[model samples]
Target: MSLDSVAENILNHLWMISWQICILAIVVWGLCKVFSRSSASFRYWLWCIILLRLCLPGDFFQADREGYYIPNSLPTVWETPVTIEDALPENYTGSSSPIVNEPYISLHLSFPGVIVLLWGLCALFLGSIVILRAVYAYAQIKIYPRIEDPAILNLLEECQKSLGIKKHIEVLLSPKESDGPFLTGILFPKIILPQHVIHSWKEEELAPIVLHELAHLKRRDLVVNWLQILLQIVYFFHPVVWYINRKIYTERELICDDLAVFYLGGKRKRYTKTMLRVLQESNDVFSAFGAVGLAEKHHFLKTRIIRILDSKYLGYKKMKKLTLFILTLFAVCSIGVFGQQQTTATKAEGEVVVTYSIFTVQDGKEKSLNPEIFFLSGVDVKKQQKFAPGEYTLLISQAGYHHILKKISIPDGVKKFHIQEQIQPLRREIKKTSKDGVDIDVVIDGDFPAGERIDPEIVALNGKDVRDNVFQPGTYRLKISQPGYATIEEAVTIPKDAKTFVISRTLSTNVRKVITQISYDVQDNKRPQITMEKIGTKEKILINSDTKIKPDSYLLHIYQQHYFPIVSKVHVWPDDRPYVMQFQLVSKPVRIRLDVRYDDKKNLPQQLVTLSDLEGKAVQVVHDNHRIKPGKYMLNIQHPDYTFGREKYIQIHPGDQFLILEKMAKKASSPSGKEYTKLFFK
Candidate 1:
């Protein structure tokens, strides 16, 4: 494959892998509960699991690929074209066939190719730097000053005995500028120390750092560190992987500190002091994953001290091992639970369950068939298992035989729905071929209304235009179709003797024009009710996004309370353009502030301000500053303890703002003389 193709594949892999990483991250986050109160060993294992996931690409972890139907090109089915964005400067009226068969992607390289190339270059640069740093660190180990003090060796031996460690470790003193202490290597472990601290450090002060490095070897962290660095070089683009690597190293230090403190009379203060001194002297390249350094990035120093001083941390004896075992089991199971691809083929409440099945055409006498290479519709999502209620087209085609298509309509109704179909086999016959093999002409015979034309889209077997097609002596399926008409499927049999054959078809028209008008509460200042007026009759339909309507002229209206209503005249006809109705309800808003009152309270009566339309549909406002469309509505104040003594009708106009203060509750026996504020901004 060419580099372009390889890049494209990598781009696709990254796209898939990104989503897999997201699922694994969520599972890992939940597994972190074990690290909270359990041993550091589990957290190290968890980091390993995350790093393992990073090394895997998207294709590595997936459920069995389910067999799904693939659709072919058909005339009965229509779809919006896929065009490159910004390819055209003009507004997309969707009036023309936007299929620019050539690459309209501009420039030679594809967009995905550009992204993949950029990622590859970045990975190459970062991987080279990492490898170079690892080589340099190893070279530094070779030339660094060696610590040959016998007393220091005895102190290391003593600490190792207390921790039950048996591996032989070599000690080398780093340059004065180097970081305090660190451990590196696998078969032969090396403990590197700074020269300045080695000369001035007391045996007790230096022993903790030495033992801390030894703890790593016992925990087999050096091997994990190598794995982390190698995978980091491979997946350099993933920030999550790098972050988890840091967490692993940070927690490694904390765990080793626990081991070293256990050796020194569990003296947390003395161990912390030693770490602080080491932090000040050490200056090594801490980015090397395999090198277990004494000091973390300076920001983590406060946290390290806290963890060392804290009674309960990772490696503490706060929680029982059984709990840790169960948590580890639970974490492993959680990862496994979400690791595999989710198989969710669910039907929502009140949604119809649709099942699509296919059978191949039976050959000769044996009526057996296989379900392969059939196209079904309404399967929008990739690997979608279930079908929802909607209009879909199923197209079937075979070699030498004409294509057969059926428009499948699953209407909203009961729960269970099933559709089964058998493919039709094409018949072949030996015949004489003239200068022109066969001629299939498409004709439309019907009276169409003005501004509408029946341009029959004729398709023949073998995907040839039936309007003027040449074919061998065989049975051919001819599909002659037009928008807003019933499709006719005809089979044309060309005779051997005859030089020409004509397959003439007729088209029929149905009611495909509609006009609509809609109206709702104008005073509420909410969205208007939009509906379509039915064709040949006075009916209405509430049109939502993606609603399929018959090809007809329509008048759509969406009007609120008092302003002028929106009117749209839409005509759906056969064309390369979309039938657009660019119109909206026009209205001006008026702001209204309400002050509710009771028997003796001046305002704030604790009443709901209710506004209702003529249809008695009401919307309640709990606070002030509400904008209402210019219209008439019933205004009333309501409270739990008392009812509105009277109801009022209010009319708001454009560019009007007002405050309405009215009596809120049922009047008391002697409160008839009480005054009220003006109800409108006069």
Candidate 2:
């Protein structure tokens, strides 16, 4: 094939594969939305799958097979060679035919050829721009000087140690003060920091900055950045690809932020403030060099800051192995479905001409086929058509007729074949009957007392008892009633078409007088406030004595000063007598004092004490008294000078309790010279 033909073929293949790539991209995008709350690294990795799929061929896992030829509305014409004697008529006296002596050639480019040329030129143009930008950024990097400050070097070393990174990384100071910190280079990874930041920022403030850049190295984001650039160069025309690229970059920064927060002992406020300051004072200039930065885009600053403060990001939970496996499996399956090549049909010389006809079987007789009938394959087989000798599925369908599908095979030696199928007409039976009474069943919807039997006579139709459970086909008033429930009154119509009718209703509770009494033990003789609330609703009514309220299942609540609130379920039945409920409220315990002391018996002041549930959720400390609900809790103590191990699991119960925690002696350094503190509580 000529070069143009070859290029056209490749372009056609790419165009086909581009749609498949788009499908995979959409699938990955949807999965990312589904797992939006998952780890940012997981989402980033999910986007990487699309990039990998884009590099695959269209028929990567497709199997070679024979194509099946099916006829369409267009008829195939065959031409035969004719001799000179056969071409001339018997009455013709023509001697010769006219001919031209001059010769000319016509050069024409096909539509596909033009498209291929355009695509090539556009790709070349964009690819050149990308290369030039990368070159310029790299050249700019060569002019920047590497930092040699001892304090900054020590801080970098400490950050590296904290992140457990063993790779040799270089630190460069940007020539301009507006440039932010970013990690560049794949082989020799270098971290570029703004000159002003290095001179003005404190070591404590710079720790998170260095840690964020080092995280990119630890996660090998630079390599992924190169892949992203390559995808952009290839699929530059695809808008979805650009959107996905933006999402990948956003998630990448979020992942780095998570890593930075984790290594900083989960101090998000300080790190977030530093990140905001850095982004505010810096500009995005290193991304063109294919580098990953802390804040690459100003618009993403809000998202980054919000995500930094989010508890989910702060927790930094890794994606589960099962979830990862499922996602990978789904992507692979999608590739298999979308990447498979479509079979091409080719006509053979030794094919058979087939004619098809349909007839309907009505009233036990064959009749002419309906004009509305057609084949499911969308082939109008009114004329004869050539087909390869193979098995084919014939789908004949029409309105008001049962669809028929028949399989037929044409023998190789056959020159012609006829396929005739009979379809059965659909018949529906309709019955006409005299109008009659319908059975009316009344159903009561409510929480009834267990083992309580309800009589059907409670329901009355048209102000009369419906003892027979049948009503004539006419409109009538329905009155449904039950004890402790408001009576329901409505007009209902019984239709002659339906054989039975059901009336279901939920009756509201009836209003009644309620009296509640509560007693509690306290230092002062004070009456607690009493309130009554209906179950499954937000309506609350204060009750003391002879308070008119709905009669149903309600919650009785009593609250007093220095006492635990009491809640009890009370059921009031319908009666003329006053409903009375009594309850005894328990008094709350005194405040629990937490005493933390060193081995020398000195109180540990300025220490942060927190009580959390077993699930790590902070428990509310009421009135600075540490009065919490009785349950098992984990106690955590934080101090700048002291090191606390894992949280202590403590069980709290009702009543007065005292906790005394004493610090043990510092253990000898295990060669690393790291001191450890152990606390025991009783």
Find the candidate with the highest lDDT and give its number: 2
Each model's TM-score? 0.42, 0.44
List ranges where model 1 is wrong by over 4 Å. Answer: 1-9, 30-44, 60-109, 280-289, 311-315, 318-324, 342-682
Candidate 1 total steric clashes? 22
Report how far off residue 417 is in candidate 1 (Å): 30
CA lDDT, every model vs. true structure: 0.58, 0.64
Clashing residue pairs in candidate 2, if any? none
lDDT of 1 by residue, 1-682 (tens): 1234345556656765566666666666667773466576566566666666666554311222221222323322222211222222245332111111111111346777888778878878878887888788787776654456789989888878877888877888776454547788888788887667677889888888887888888888888888788777766777877778887777677777777777677788998898787666654325233587667666677678887777664333434677568657755674565444432222233545555554443445323333322334423222443555666544333333333344445544334444444444433232344575754433243223321124565556656765444587777776766665666777767778555564544455544323333333342445556777744557777765445565545677666554566776654664333334444455666788776666666565345577777566855442466677666677877554556866788776555576777765554442222222122100
Looking at model 1, report the run of 10 residues with the lowest lDDT sum. Answer: 97-106
lDDT, model 1: 0.58
Model 2 is weakest, by summed lDDT over 10 consecutive residues, at: 97-106
lDDT of 2 by residue, 43-156 (tens): 887887777777776531122222222232211110111122332334545331111011111134577777777877888998898889889999888767667678988998
